[model samples]
Target chain A: MATTEAARPIAVATTPHRRTRWRHVLTGSVVPRVILIVSCLVFLAPFYWMVVSALKTNTELAQFPPSLIPGAWAFNNFPDAINYIPFGLYTFNSLVITVGATIGAVLSNTLVAYGFSRIQWPGRNALFYLCVATIFLPYPVILVALFDIFGRLPSFGIQGAKSWVDTFLPLIVPAFFGNPFYIFLMRQFMLGIPKELSDAAKVDGASELQTFWRVILPLTRPAVIVVLILAAVAAWNEFLLPLLYLQSNDKYPLAVGLIFFTSEHDVSYNLLMAASTLIVLPVVIIFLVAQRFFIEGITVGGVKG
Target chain B: MTAAATSVKPRSVGRFRLGTLERRNLKWGLLFISPWAFGFIALGVFPILYTFFLSLTRYTGFRSPTLIGFNNYTTMWNDPDFWKAAYNTLYYTVLAVPIGVVVAMLLAIAMNQKVREVAIYRAIFYLPSILPVFAISFVFVVLLNPGYGLVNLLLTTAGLPSPNWLGDPAYTKLALVMIAQLGAGQWALVFLAGLRGIPIELYESAEIDGAGAFRRFRSITLPLMTPVILYDIIIGLSFGLQVFTSAYILTGGATRGGAGPDNSLLTYVFYLYQQAFQFGSMGYAAALSVVLFLASVILAMAVFRWARGWVFYGGEEA
Candidate 1:
């Protein structure tokens, strides 16, 4: 197989120009098409299995030589899965964290990016390098110490809060501080804007913030949207932080809550799959709706790195 | 003053005596970046230092820490479970990173094909990369069930032996590797971008020079992709070392210290979590974390140094 694939290129290269077109169509397209089609099936199979398992009956789920298609489409399983766990409450918690984190990510990253890109200040590049270097610092390195910091938050004189440990603050508040990755993305995008636009706004008697707000921010809409989607998706899929911080069942996001549901309940494969589908549906929809930004953000990050 | 400062280049100004506009710009720049600066200090810097401090103490969550010198590190050095966790983590990283890179590179090449349904194929491949890892883990739990599972059924049909994927110690880490491949699409996208950046003219020129497609790919495409490949490997190494969530979920996390059948699935971070939260040995976990941090930094540095020989920058002579 490998030899043939390698030999085809030589064959095509040496072939007569008129005949080469037919050879290209036959050899070039066929192999790639077959490879891609097989790959597509392999990648999509789990999703198909996930959906089919979600719709299967308990008896059908337990059957040996498991049927490829669900024998019965138990649509009620969706509602049942929701009822089996506090799905509504978990969804609300997930929403609160996702929205809070997304807003914080966009606002903080844009402001920091503006500072790093538009303003020419002493030590700017040095500070930006420090910011970028934080990307390599593994999260576990900070996990224990941050937990201690948050666990001791009440002692530092924040009124009415007992501890930051059990609250959504730990997960959401950090986003307000600016993630290094998002800051990098926003800075790269902001750097591409013509300097004349900000200068014109400044010459019209605008303050730096005003010029940023009026001229630069509007131009950075695409980058902001990219940051927004990435942040929301990240927050939605976050498991470790939530698993560590939120102690109460009521506060658990869908990511952590699903684990609680499975561990506490007897194994119900169908119900679990149904719940998994429900949790994954929103992310799938978000990706479909704003996929361009996701790809743009990823490629930009990859290329820059 | 503002106009004068603007006329003179900011870098050319004296260190202590700044121009009016330069000073103003400095103030606003600091102001704009204050949030991240505060977070960087409070979260990033402070925590790292404190983690080192905590690693030297004997503390539980409820009580104050007592300084214990280097006892925690000595204990970690002697602990067999610690070594086991380290070994398991190394095993996972060594196997998963290279396999993932190859799969991603192949997928990128396939996606770059001129087929009409390429968009659909790209989307299909990339979808699994974005779905929550925990959800994917759960899906695999059923798919790899020893009895009546889809995988086992397929294996039986093919007259092949299907070892218990999750139950057996030998196959547990491999199961996680299989799960890791689901996210290859994410890197595949990155590789796709790299592939796109390679000039088509180079291939055309090579073809006219009687270079086969294989030769063109070997010489022109592979050299150009070295930088991206280096980036992917570094990122993959870090991620591979930090493999926690899937193992945690698969091994039944709520059971407390369930590290999967004789601790075959006890990844480094998972062990750290068990020590810190599950067992309430905060100080010990801090030591584990410090080791992880050092290892990561050292390995990354080693890779970068090693890469000097192979990584081809486009502007440089290869």
Candidate 2:
């Protein structure tokens, strides 16, 4: 990918006269572009339909053949959808979990990754391998046991909580434990930082913690951002864990809450779409704004595998 | 500094003597990783081991457990619903993974094209992937509505029979498979990265040798992409086996045990969830978890073992 990026400017620089011809040739090959355009449309059709349906009146939604565009723009449906359920409460719950998880993920993963990467300790490589191996272990294998463990949290005498079940603790607390994927990603990123920087910090009489905080962590901003975005997205989108752990309707995250909205008696299709659109909006905005991080994070993790 | 010291005087490991520096390094390393280590033990290893222990005992959440030997496993062996869930999960994996890989590869190829609007195309393709699956499931419910859903409406316009996607048991799993394709863009990005990693010179040289595009792709692109494909297959298998959310939402809720019409959407994880939470068969659920873990590990190993035959490394020996 880097090589392709590097080659393009050079090609244009050296063959300035042929650039127009090259552009013409590129544009003249229409089949690939047509296929791409059509595929993009196919890919986006559902979202387009979703937005269109969200704007439709109930009568229009009940039409024999749904209109491509809504007959009347039912803008009130968004507010109505939110009012129908505890959308605000669900959004708040989702935010709390997402924010909590992201913070934990960033802190734990960075620290753990530093240990795995920067330090030269005996058994480090073997331990890092063990951490990475955990990535392959099916999460469902531990679900039942984790549920049991969290369910017993009240017995452990934690303050201000009856049980970890029916609370955000199960969803939020796990992020404080380093995820193997993020650890691996951060470790890879940390390894690329020059050892001399850390050595220099040490020579200047800084502690290992100080060296990490002041020197290494600053240089790791991009990787940290990647972890943050990925963790936030995962936390926001997480379903099974939250579904299992959270019992109260008022405490439900948007992911779980949306299902409840759909299961209501005689669900208004337009209102459902409106709520779905609302739930999807933040993620779409985040992806658009931080597109590079999303692509880079996934590709980097995948390519190294 | 420490790395340089280690390089100069490689420590003798047979006796395993630790110097002051080594001890300090070890202490700091352990300190830095304490959170993860604690988590690994508490959340990961302990849970896994406890799951195994739980699988052997009959326990409800509210009551004490009684040792049942391997009765849960034995029961699972004879249970028709367990087999149905297993089959549904397998059927979904067999279809979804390969289809996802192909769709992703095709999308990757399209994205790799030197089109002016490639970034926009890439964004459009990937947009659906990052959206919450639950929301997507809701959208799918409306889109796959039998009477006037977008999918069936399109099928009708194209002069094809529009089957009940969510209603019919035969089509329920198939509907989930179609929904799974929406997330192919995530893997497509990986494939795109792999495609980019292939040296352009290989194609240029192949062009000079009078090899057609198909020949170039077969000999060069496909072989080089086998590793990424293998990665995708392994990841896809794990995800495919654990599929729950869409099915859970589509089939009303956990109250319905997440089993769609005629149990078509009763995926392995869904079944396990139902067993543990809904039915209060914690022991049986634990057993299901154990089998799922074993299946994931064995299947992953099998893929790796098979990959040895076909996956090509650029410079390293396979």
Candidate 3:
């Protein structure tokens, strides 16, 4: 077999334009175009409102007849948002948690997933199924217990009786042990790699680890990229775990940090909206920059099952 | 010489005996995968088994769980809210999941069209999925705020009476279901990928066999895509049962008060959150969690069993 080949010429063939006259009239007609425009508007409306609200002052935003666009674009609102919360600290905290967790998860889960997919080790299937089955276990169920477990670790002399909540232990440690979802994704991707490639590597006197590192790892970069994007997005959007575990205001991620600013006493809608807009900016930019790779990664690796 | 070497069998101790290299690889594999396996057995499996045991007991946060022998299970039998929560969840799942799958599939199929400006369109459609649920929730609240809300405003303009969306019990679930489906970007992309997987030759052959578009989809497309559909169904169902943040946030968090008006939007997870954190009934909340777990496992196992009948593999028989 012509396996271990780095690249193959992709044959691009255009989709046949088999649009019959009636079929074209029915689907490619003006009516469908109008509907599409309307649908697009419906989809875009909420996002537009978020942007518009973020830019408007409280009085302007709270008006009876809603403003489609802000009267005077309050460019200051974005700057005001920074002071609304300890935005810098929150961003830093979020960065530490997301980056650390994603890096750890990708590293750990890839190795575990690779082991399961490539090796015919004993109890592997049972272990993989165990991981899959745990996918349905609600986090809330084990959270209190996990906290208890974390609390007792002073016996091991790690934290010296400090609550794990104040530290990034809860968010960071669970990730170092492979996440089930990422493991599943990596396993799927690994399975798709032809066995012949690895066999050929072995025939050339390569060990399993060498084949994994030099051959498989390099080849599965797309899947790894996908995992990275997913891990980052998941860590970013994560709220419940952070709120449950992280205690100090300074230690808060952006998602949880913003909540403190919107408490009942001074729920400044303008500032809240501005902060919300700012919180989403990083994610939006990341999405845009990695648009092609992200979609391919998610659709191919993450989304399948 | 190479042909002769290939023809010769590899030297081995015996069929039952492992070579040093193979043993080393196996040991290395175990070492490499130890984190997951250890975590699984230690954290995952232990907690699950412990929780199963704990569900039978009345354990508060600080105390040892005393076994009550199905007292919790009996309580669920009589608890109106248990049934109510189940009904509400099932209602939401039924309305949301299929509509979500269909709408997502349709959106994917539509976006898969050959057109310029498609990337922007894709981004526009997918924007909601990545945007924080908080942002979307706030936007929806403002947009569906009964009086000055855009949706109600439009409804009133069309001479139709507008109902309270998040406020009223009758429309609360419907409103949630509708809003939930709005974030179909991820699912749409998945379906789009699955759509690409169906061999063009199969569709073309169906067309040549005088099958109409609908017929071709039903016969060839649906059968081939059954695995993806099954996967989505399981995932959608699991996620549907865990509807918390939206309902919790919409009800203005625990501090704002209990789940939306008349407990209309009180999902199982939301209710569990209330009981455990807000009400300080950790024991009761843990029981509820177990109940939710059981429900999810049963549903998942059912889907898996059903997959044996309907989900078509590429080469394997169902």
Question: TM-scores of all models?
Answer: 0.94, 0.92, 0.87
Candidate 3, CAPRI quality class derived from DockQ: acceptable
Query: How would you order the candidates by DockQ, starting with the best?
Result: 1, 2, 3
Off by over 4 Å in 2: A1-28, A155-161, A303-305, B1-15, B255-258
lDDT of 3 at A14: 42
- Among these predictions, the greatest lDDT belongs to 1
TM-score of chain A of each: 0.90, 0.87, 0.85
> Could you tell me which residue pairs clash in candidate 1?
none
State the fnat of model 3.
0.30
lDDT tens per residue, model 3, A150-252 = 5445433323426564577778877788878778878888889998888787777776778889988988887788788878887888877777666566778
Which residue runs does candidate 1 get wrong by more than 4 Å? A1-23, A155-161, A303-305, B1-16, B316-318
What total of clashing residue pairs does each candidate reach? 0, 0, 0
B133-207 per-residue lDDT for model 1 (tens digits): 898888888889888689899888999998899999999999999899888887888898899888777876677
TM-score for the B chain of model 2: 0.94
Off by more than 4 A, model 3: A1-22, A28-37, A122-126, A136-138, A155-161, A192-211, A301-305, B1-21, B63-67, B114-117, B306-310
| Number of the predicted model whose TM-score against the real structure is largest | 1
What DockQ does each prediction reach against the true complex? 0.53, 0.52, 0.30
